[model samples]
Target: MITTLRFTMLFAAALCAAGCGSDDEPAGSGTPGTGATTSSQASSGTGSGSSSGSGGSGSGGTGTGGDVTTTVVVNEISAKGSDWIELGNPGSAAADLGGFGLCDSDATGLCNTGDALRFPEGTELGPGEYLLVLGDQAVEVGPGPHTTCLAEGPSSCFYATWKVSASRGETVFLISPNDHVLNQLEYPMEAAADGQTWGRLPDLTGQGGVTAPTPGAANAAP
Candidate 1:
């Protein structure tokens, strides 16, 4: 809130300064009103004219602005029993859900279409919290930082309906709120001699990566 207000104050000050400089002409000039006052002429008038106009304009506004420094982070992705994608908002301001989306890649291509879960008018994810979304539903619907266990049991299987079944070498993708791909997981469905089945790759942030298992056997968690 303070950040947005600060930006607004700065912007308003700028606009007022810009407007004041153009308001000191005569009644025929191209200044704000009908007046003709050149720089030399206005400079000669009482400095009070510029200062007064600036003060008036600056004090006339509401002094409010929208969110600033807002961002969304993909914290975790699970495609097992119930496909669930977890998002974290580590920003100072809340994010609007109006323009977010989720998409998948396949032969048919990006097949997600439904209502988008918009952060409610005052919905904010407070810093360091998670927004867990069930894949099958619209991207806009989810358990935000303030929600309990999806209103379902603690098994996490509530998301099972959204899981993407993997073949021996298939892949799964977790898209962003903008429908852009966030991360992908390519793993071996069948366990190897080491007993570890592939999981989501590590070290993925803004782009992409491969999902591989750590030093463990199949059924090991990522």
Candidate 2:
């Protein structure tokens, strides 16, 4: 009877010990939460979004890269013989001169405008090239196709609206069609006279001075 009772006690102790043995690994040993994101998962999601956007159904013609803005400046001016205004391209690229504008004085608009001129269509200027604009009629030169003077230029001809005042020098303005001023200067009264011309000394860089005529060509020392 005593041996049987001891054997039953030992069996009960073994059952308790086996049930209490820990089966858990650790606190952080489980899988990640459903809301958590890994770095690789984030990268993969971004790549998929980009790919889906590129696969959208949209079409268009080839792109021209939009309008290119190039540098074209006033190279020379002449209030004397033929009354020519010269433009120079000092840059290394070709520029479209279409829709460029000029004015003898500051032009507010068409009503109170001084002598203003506009370049004809299809006008172009190349690298290191020169352009000459002449005054023929004694009237104001409005925008394109409104001038009376014919273009005698190789590339294109632009005519001044009114004769440049040699006696009463006024402001000379070079503007784009969008009313953007490219170059402007105040021509002092009697800036050039007696067949002498007012122009840029070294073509594109030097200061303005009275020099010999170099219409449609490089400027030289007077």
Worst 10 residues of 1 by lDDT: 52-61
lDDT of 1 by residue, 1-222 (tens): 999999999998988876565455565645565655422101112121221111111111112221111344443444444455454444444544333333333333232323323333333344444455555653343523332344432223112123433443233333323333322333234322232233322221222222333211111242
TM-score of each predicted structure versus truth: 0.36, 0.56
RMSD versus native structure for model 2: 19.7
Query: C-alpha displacement of 146 in model 1, angstroms?
Result: 11
lDDT of 2 by residue, 7-99 (tens): 999999999987654567555656766564322100112111121111111111111222223466665666655676777776666666666
Best by TM-score: 2
The lDDT of each candidate is 0.35, 0.54
